[model samples]
Target: MYQYSEFDRQFVRLRAEQFRDQLERWQAGQLSEEQFLPLRLQNGWYVQRYAPMLRIAVPYGEISSAQLRVLAHIAREYDHPDAALLAHAQATQDELQASQPGLTLAAPPLRYGYGHFTTRTNVQYNWIALTKAADVMDLLASVGMHGIQTSGNAIRNITCEALAGIAPDEIVDTRPFAEITRQWSTLHPEFAFLPRKFKIAFNGAAEDRAATGWYDVGLQARRNSAGEVGFTVKVGGGMGRTPIVGSVVREFLPAAELLNYLEAVVRVYNRYGRRDNKWKARIKILVKAEGQKYIDAVEAEYAAIVAQDGAPHTITAAELARVQAGFVVPALSPAGIPSEVSITAKPYQRWLKQNVRPHRLPGLSVVTLSFKRPGFAPGDADAATLDALAELADTFSAGEARLTHEQNLALPWVHASDLPALYEHAQALGLVQPNIGLLTDMIACPGGDFCSLANARAIPIAAALTEMYQDIDEVTDLGPIDLHISGCINSCGHHHSGHIGILGVDKDGKEWYQVTLGGADGSALSGPAMPGKVVGPSFSAAEVPDVVEAILDTYRAQRSSAAEHFIDTLRRVGHEPFKQAANGARHAATERRSHARQAEAATA
Candidate 1:
């Protein structure tokens, strides 16, 4: 965890005071909604259905025990949702109407200020019963935090690989560079307001853990011919209405010039990127509008600004050393020897195998806490759990816990001998599920529930599919599978990389979905899932289970063996067979009531 200096602390405090004054005026009726909207949004406040909700950006998804405690404190003080979600109605709208005698009641709207720590997409604090949002900003500033740059058409949080320094395959410790990038990009006057939001990711290893291909700019740390550090740059990729996987612009970018080159890239986008339609404002659209050759040429010209005009940017060796020093992976009771490795030696070995990775030191490994396990909300941890993790990290992991883009937690420096004890503690805390890399582990975005721009609720759909594939031992046999779901076309869930991807849409004001197959996320296995065939209009919760079951069953019947993954089977057979199984009258979930209502509705 990076400690705030006096400069940071004072800056946040001043910003808080400024925002508090602004918000007080708004509440007193001096500032109109129109006057306050952009100012509050820039400060990370949004006017939602109920109240103003503030989103704090956790760049590259890293947070400390102290920070987590502050978040919990904030939740306790601000969230007004203690009176939420107790009255149980039918689990599904269909279940309530037919099974029980007809009684109609509007489901109560859910409560506010729920703290959801999601994998990589964002962490949302549903805390706005705020009559004074600016005051909240001031409070956050008092704690050395703020909502700055968390929203708006500026450089968004620069994301990086969760396993940047931990993954065994990494070429360089990307954490250092990611931190540098975060600081450089934060409130940068040159980039504070851009044509649109920008996203950047760096994968420090060979394996694309960061989903680099799907970002506006993805950098992979690699070694160049002169035996120096550099990156392979992928440009113009993004997820939105038009999702495009970035193309490789530079095969090798020297470490010294990476930042300047990045500046150049931003300059090009800022100068020529669209300001016309919000939907078409991403760098991807600009790249599409301008040929790749032209963009590549701009980068080359800017390379001099990087290597020569070099007032000083990019990660210098000293800066790298300073940043890495903050994340010293702690001196654990023993960094090299985990305390209870033998406890998880058998059934839990898979957890250790996939979830844990070797750190930079001699024997220390970075242990990942998987939130994507069966039955758990992806990236969600309650207040107690958050506290326990903070305690464990402080006591066991050198008091450091880094949040992942995947919305899980990480204790970066654990000894091999201490693994079992940690595993047991984790189990007691409801964090021990061995489903890493399995189909049950899913990546989804917060669809319509919280986001203003989403089409459907992605979390429930993901939960449905996760429960839909409960028979894990059997599903494991099908091999590696990635199923990404997005509320809308923004592709926040990385649907294009999934072996099977589901995108939620609205058809004529009716909720419906489209399914795509054959998409992948790697060099060996990367391709678009074919455009989805529309499915369901107001499909019952019961129907969702059947739809997933049909897909798995269809795969099992055609699969050569359990060794074959979902994508392989999809290509081996075709999408039509699965579609038939999902939509055909033979399925009990869909037939009770036709989904015809949605098809007749207007385009979503």
Candidate 2:
């Protein structure tokens, strides 16, 4: 974890103070809602369905235990809605359920006082009041955290592989580069409000764990035959109404010119990207529409920047070294490594196999605590859980933890000898679920429950599927499956990349779900980065669980062998059988609905 310097601490504190002034003026009627909108958004505050949502940026997914505790404090003290607001929201939800009887499973009452981890490695609070926003910001500043550039049409959080520095096959540690980019992009006057929100990701390892292909700017670190480090820069990738894999704009960009090249890329996009239409504003659309022309324009811009502007943003070796020094590995006692563990419990063995991962260091390991369990939305952690996680990090990982792109917390420096005790502690805290890549370990957005833009509620659908697959053996038997859900076309849940993607759609003012099959996130398991194909018409929320089960059943029946994964089978057999199975489940659900109606009519 990067420690905050005095200058950095002062800068954050000053920013918080400025926000407090802005918030006070807005409350005093000195600033209109129109005027305050951009200001508040710049500070990472958004007015969601029922309340304000705050997004706290976790740069490159790195977080310290102290920062974690501050986040917990914010969740506990500020993430609360008034009783009337809660009741009204609940009533509205109930009315929606009543209007569409049998279309959805019974969902538990809505709760607050939690933080949500996003696929972008940010933390979000759904119920924080705008009045208390400054206080939360101040608290975050105390620990070198903030919500800067988390929202608006500016460059958002810069993300890297969760195992950035510690991956066994890492070619270069991306954290320092990611951090440098973050510092450069933060409040950059030239590209503050671009055509739309821009995202950048880095992948240093041979494997694409960061899903770099799905970002606006994807940087894959590589070394040339001459032993010089650089990046294979991919541009114009995004997922929304349009999901396009990024194209390689530069085969090899010198590491020193990362910012200079990025400046050129965003400069071209900013000048030509669609501003009239929000839907087509992303750099992807511009790049897609222009193709090679866009690449040429960026190249020209880069040449001009170097020739005319003196390449002002070039990263010097000294600057790079300064940033790199902040990422030193924590001291670990060599005695922590034992030849072998003697634990024989099945649960312990399962957790060790599922949640634990190899580290570059000999005696250390990486452990991911699952947040996709039942009774909570994926990536959600309550205040108590957040505090407990901080404690766990301090105790086991030298006060360091990283938020993963998959909406989970990972301790990257856990000692191998502490695995058993750590597993027992995490299990006691309900954080040790041995389903890391399993079907139930799904990615989902807050959906209609919290997001005003959502067409349907994602939580209930996630809950339905989670409840159906509670049997660990059944889940493990199904093998590694990426099940992702989103409440709308925003693709916040990264549904477009899921092996089995569920997207909530609006049909005649009712909630419906469209299932897509054979999507891949460019992982070793998923061969390439490609969007999933829709199977058929959207199904009701109630039918989603059955549809999923049908898809899984189809995979099980069509698989060449027990060891074959679902994706492999889907690729081999194609989507025809799976599509038919999903539609069959929908028809069965319809028949059941019709029979229930008839039975009710006869009774009446």
Candidate RMSDs in order = 5.4, 1.7
Question: What is each predicted model's overall lDDT from 0 to 1?
Answer: 0.68, 0.92
Candidate 1 residue-wise lDDT, 292-410, digit = tens: 76477666659667567863675678877777887655455653334444653555776777677777666677787777644445665656666778777876687777777656778
Indicate which candidate wins on lDDT.
2
lDDT (10s digit) by residue, model 2, range 230-293: 9999999999999999999999999999999999999999999999999999999999999999
Q: Return the TM-score for each candidate structure.
A: 0.86, 0.98
Residue 594 of model 2: what lDDT?
89
Clashes of each: 21, 0
